[model samples]
Target: MTELAIGHVTTDCAHAADLAGFYAALLDRSVDPGATEFFATVGRESGAHPVLMFIQVPDRTAGKNSIHLDLHAPDVAAEVARAIGLGAKHVADFAEYGAVWTTLADPEGNLFDIGTGQA
Candidate 1:
């Protein structure tokens, strides 16, 4: 069988550059050059899958996101604070599975989580 890997994960937004910029700052990834208002990317496109990609859309995705990203941080609270500073809104907090995590919405309302890895 041919090897399979995710080339990129894309999300649609009214303006690609805005969403891409948010993720890039949040993930500490670099925005690829030549990005236009219609499309943009975070992370180096030359190597690997580039991790994330964004495309412009007429309307935002409706309802809750069917898929979301769960992030890990040594200090969940501090990370959450930083994310909020970066324009992420705190959605809620969860304590289960022997861990604690906080859900946040990006500038475009895409959901993601930040958690304390150890107990």
Candidate 2:
């Protein structure tokens, strides 16, 4: 057996609650009530295995993120539009590896990619 499994991805923000709400809306998940002011988690009701956690920090300096998420969706265009409507800003759209994808930034300027699950 593997010693490790995939865990949640964490994001640092000035306002953990706000960022958690943003992601909750975008991902169609709910913010877990166990979260505190400085930490929030977006998790599914069925299970708490995979989650996105937000941690509040005193200062949030602007800089390019070295790591980002790549989400796979059945309809990339629709998902991108929905994310934009939920406050994500569109960055770019491109095709690579026989797949089409769009880049977007969250409210706090965290960049993520949405792509059609094609190869």
Q: What's the lDDT for candidate 1?
A: 0.84
Residue pairs in candidate 1 whose N, alpha carbon or C atoms collide under 3 angstroms: none
For residues 6-119, write the lDDT of model 1, one tens digit per residue.
778888887888888888888777778978789898865645353688899887769899888777888888889999999999999999989899999999888988997756
For each candidate in turn, the TM-score is 0.88, 0.88
TM-score of 2: 0.88
Reference-based lDDT, each prediction: 0.84, 0.86
Where is model 1 more than 4 Å wrong at Cα? 46-50, 117-119
Write one digit per residue (lDDT tens) for candidate 2, span 1-119: 87997678899987788888888888788888867769988884447666788999887667889888888999898999999999999999989889899999999899999998687
TM-score of 1: 0.88
